[model samples]
Target chain A: MAYTAEKPVPPPSSDELRARIPGWGADLDPADRPSFPRESLDLRPEGAHWDFPERQEPDGPRERSVEHKFLTPVFGTAQPLTGISGVIRRYAYDRFSEGRAAHWLLLIAGDRVDAIESHLKSFATFRPDNPITETGLMAEVKRHPIRSRFGRGRADLRHTWIDPILVAGPWVLTGWLVLKVLRPKR
Target chain B: MRAMTYRGPYKVRVEEKDMPKIEHPNDAIVRVDLASICGSDLHLYHGLMTDLRIGHTFGHEFIGTVHEVGPSVQNLKVGDRVMVPFNIYCGSCFFCARGLYSNCHNVNANATAVGGIYGYSHTTGGYDGGQAEFVRVPFADVGPTIIPEWMDPEDALMLTDAFSTGYFGAQIGDIHEGDTVVVFGAGPVGLAAARSSWLMGAGRVIVIDHLDYRLEKAREFAFAETYNFNEYDDIVVHMKKITGFLGADVAIEAVGAEADGNLLQHITAAKLKMQGGSPVALNWAIDSVRKGATVSVIGAYGPIFNAVKFGDAVNKGLTLRMNQAPVKRQWPRLFEHIKNGYIKPSDMITHRIPLEHIAEGYHMFSSKLDDCIKTVVVPNAS
Candidate 1:
């Protein structure tokens, strides 16, 4: 059989992709699926030729929905932890819940329903490729009328008991020490 | 330079190609002295693997002399003979630091499924394999080891993948002093695993396969009992009866995807690509091993879903320990075993052909012609 080297075709527009391919993750929205970078280089072995069509798109990011969380959420790039701090940051990101009104027990009935409605509304424009942006939507949910009953700002850090104060202690002490030391040396 | 390139399923050709150069600081270009066709390469040959673009090379088992070394390649120098492990790994990754080299975090841009493997396919980091005049070895210090003066180069070639992976299969079995170990498949990996089982203090080692010739080799080379599954009505039932119905102490699956048993399963899994390679051998392993026994899998399977008998395994309280063999970790002990004459991995080599004729070699091996067990390709042959 005759063989010929094939160049990869350009990726389709986002509309074309979403129309042709159905939703892949648990949430059936085109924006919830991870996207890949366009194919730019031809790395096929030299002198190798075949009539097969080049892949239209690179493989999608690994599935990382709630049910598939155990699987790696591979993106176009591998995410390396920057250091111990990165690990702590990832842990915080995974367990972030205080911004939602579910934590508050005394919200009025109408306020609780509004919080849920706001969260559902955010999914209307959710984009999977930019998953970090979903946090912004969640932030909107945190601002619902029901969350106001808890007397905390929408961006309040998720801390239990005096942990936030404890975290602030060192900086607070440093500030006080600086004031005392720099005060008019009378 | 002439290199073997894949055109399509069951199609490969040796064509003039540009020589590879250093693409990374840790890269070392090696003039391939010898390379072998592994059984797992058949997945690409049969078009089972995804993303195997045309013109891609298909090889992972190779040995060569260093032609050039990049600035950061610390342990290796020019002209040193080295045996590279199959997995391309960065030494400092979290997985590599824990000795899980096959799952190295760096190297492969798509490492969520597999770490870098030379020339297997684009899914395996897309690095061109050594089935040519040369191969680019990445992370040279961490993955490739210098060949000891006393070791045979062919032996060193086997150490790169097949032998090391086979020994790992036995190692993960956690064999006791007198454990009964059963190995599935009698291919190169299976044969190596069966042979290694004896060294692991296995009281009884049984190898199962449908091929009479391979089973015969298993008995002669591994010094173990062999069973041809075709002769028995139910292979697993026979294994259970032989092991006093309590099942063998441990079962090793050396046959990955493409295992043939249960015709319907073969259709859906192997032919249709509905599930991962037919879970024939793995299901047999689960059914044949004793409750709470260990099942060590070294066979190569796709990263996608497989219809494995996880519920059966869980109910039986079986421990399934599996990974792509961390090839470097087995080197020191394998070197000792080789020196002591406990295992001779090169004995399985049945044909040695030049790289130009590798397509024919692949065809013969894939077709099982002339009872071919292994075929080595020489890139520099006249």
Candidate 2:
């Protein structure tokens, strides 16, 4: 028996995927059952489409990143804006949800990826009421819908508080701005 | 009598030593009618596993006749034929209750890391092994399997480790009904994995190896299509071509080499590989799975003792399950399969010598000299 890119016992709904992603390459279906497109899972190399894409046609909500700019002041001067903007990806088990699951990110960093990681780690392992003091901000930002905008459409960034100016500014200013909002997604 | 004892670098001695005795109440003394060397035991031979102390007895694969039994022995009387599964378990422990008998705490809590087994190493269990004229079998009722009276010892001897290990490997590979399995390395364990793959209902089984003897024996016994790694410049590409470019639904890595370091490099490579973080072998096997495929590993591994990046596995949506085979859990079915002639896994044995001549058999088997697949030793046989 040969390795049919097609499974011998093909899933009944595989055709749904083919139909849904028109003109997408046939090889798009990864091995194994019920596979999603790599573009959907990895937001880095394929992040451009993880959210609603830039409107080339009638559309709303431009693709936005869950990643945020994190900054910490050294010697009382707030550090420059830096972080993996797309969000750093990882698996986060949700016991309440009833199964182990993967939490993904875009992870676009500016300079101190390491510092941001340490701060997150410290809060995760050391905090008393939970890690929300650290991760809550980032996690909330990640869950917020297209709060920032990029590319061609206002509808894409529609409702997102991400002002166009912030997207284009230097690392320091962006980090300062994101921190200043301090608004919870809720 | 000379014994296969671990000494130093490249030094396994056929040394003079005192014979072992039944130390536990459930113990039995077996006059080893047959025994075989194992690949894992080579770790001691090469001095990679430096903790076995001096003069440690080695060799886990064996078939013996019970010569004596302690007062508590009830399952079998003297003269009953038996094959000792590589590991010994007390049948009661947190691990045992979970059916992971190989990691039994009562029987092996003090000896090795997971649990105790014979002839493997200090890290496994420092127990004396059956590669001798006589061996002491602990937890005899659980460790010694009674072979039917009529079956050939050669055919029953391998029922211990290689077959079980390979079977476990195939089980890990998840060779489901009609699935195509690609097994890496055709050493004894790999051959066994291939054999088990076929028995597990795989539509096609492919065994990969650079060796000619193993490839041949794999086909003759395991019923696998063989791929000689030497024949192709690109093993993965060749494999894909054979599979029509999709890849096998499952792949098993049975070579069990800790190549990352000398003798025992601490299978950090394998551990790292598991994280979807390291090199190609594991990743290749993992990649071979049709998307969302499951990969199980039964290959024994040392602790990588570090962080693991499981992101790749998660992203690929692959589910991997691995553990040392709790042989006791599978013993009933495996024995039944043997009884019904459904599995002729023991036919791979190629050499048999008296217990006194075990040193030579070990050398031959270890060297893979003359295409030796499995070798056994007998003590009292004419």
Candidate 3:
């Protein structure tokens, strides 16, 4: 549940934050900031008449970080949470604040899981993902493969050797597993 | 009224919403006729942006009939067909006074970086976008221009962001006569940049993209030489070799955050959120330019640290110019180009979807399905 019209729960007081975290609100003093002079709020007149904007009604459940009191009045509904990846995303948002590396790492893991799910789903479709064409393997032969890689000041050269293994290894492993499962266990 | 609402990443729907009303003396309510999905909107769609609220309507490039005008509004009247620039800014702002409307301080609360952008995110002032039946436009007198009678509505829509930004991308490059230019990404902005390079006196323009379809579009639309980045082991090296081992005179990094060339960079930046955006194209732009060349970056990126090759740029003496295009600033020149048949902004549009089917539209564009170069939303289409 997220994005209520009610005012978000007030953030912890500066004193409390200062006590809890080291070097908290170090830039809170306007004097400490370089842009403080130019970042004046008095320049623009307050335009909005409402105390808070009219909230758009949510169609379904939306993921909100635990740190926020509620979701912003407006939220996206394009990609609804589903599958294991969704659960991982929900857990990341529900448990961790945006500041934590764990939160972002979990979301990244979720994206990988989602990629695998997409590949699996593609197998059921007529135009399954083509490893050769889609992976740009054909281009290696047609294009100058050796000349472009060797002696070139390419940053990606360090990981170039591992790319094929990382890309094709999963498919090869999946094929072996399928063969093992389908073979008659005599 | 119905509006395109963001449910989550890669998710959007047309939802019933209240009609927008004038909130400021300069505010105007526009009845949207045509709205577009910009290439940069994909960053928001992929959930890469911070503080993007749920149920936020996502649109910025739009042309519509003026429905209502506030008391202080004098430039426009009801029923006036106008195209709104993506940047929302007060005319009197110091930035606006210098023609830097995109960096206006008065409109967006986060005035330190960018000005207010319609439907971008809370980071850009959280202004609801124009992908609705009606959109409330602030600073209406300054941003919106009456659609020229001879201009196609679709062309007017493109001027709102894509075409203007592309033209601006080339303008800022400080391109000299007969200079060789290289543009990265073959998205609408990239194509527009390539097309504009010729206008800026570029002798040779080459566009790079992994997509063959987009490469074909670049050749056909921009009349620029196209190369599929996939067809090279190292595209930057190839670029140098082709340009007599000196590199292009100017390189435009039109591809932003979600560029797909280096797997590690893509995974770390786009997936892991390690950096603000994948700097693959930008790095390539820097690497593939001549020693004293210029690199124009008009691509949208989240405000954060990216692993850009700043040291290389310093060594090469590259003049890096970038900004959110002041759309209205380029309107006068672009209008002339469009009028003289020098550029057809609508020629790039490949799909037109009804507002109800906007969810499908987002999916199609995000996935690059059906070679969707551009998709326009007809909000009131039956």
Candidate 2 local lDDT, B42-142, one digit each (tens): 54443334223444677777888888897667787999988788876665445554556666554432222457677654335446787777777776666
TM-score of 3: 0.70
Candidate 3 per-residue lDDT, tens place, A139-178, comes to 3453345654555343334444554565566669989999
Candidate 1 lDDT over residue span B257-349, tens digit each: 878666666666655556657788999999999888999998887544688989999999999988888787678777877786667889988
Query: Each model's fnat?
Result: 0.00, 0.00, 0.00
Local lDDT at B296 for model 2: 63
For this target, which candidate reaches the highest TM-score against the unseen true structure? Answer: 3
Candidate 3 regions with alpha-carbon error over 4 angstroms: A1-186
Model 1 misplaced regions, further than 4 Å: A1-186
Instruction: Please write out the lDDT profile of model 1 over residues A1-186, one tens digit for every residue.
Output: 122232111223435433432220111221211110001122111111212211212343331212122432112111222333233323332343223222111111222232233333435744212222311222233223243224322111122223224323444776899899999987
Each model's lDDT: 0.66, 0.53, 0.74
lDDT of 2 at A53: 17
Q: List TM-score per model, in order.
A: 0.68, 0.62, 0.70
TM-scores (chain A) of the candidates:
0.19, 0.15, 0.62
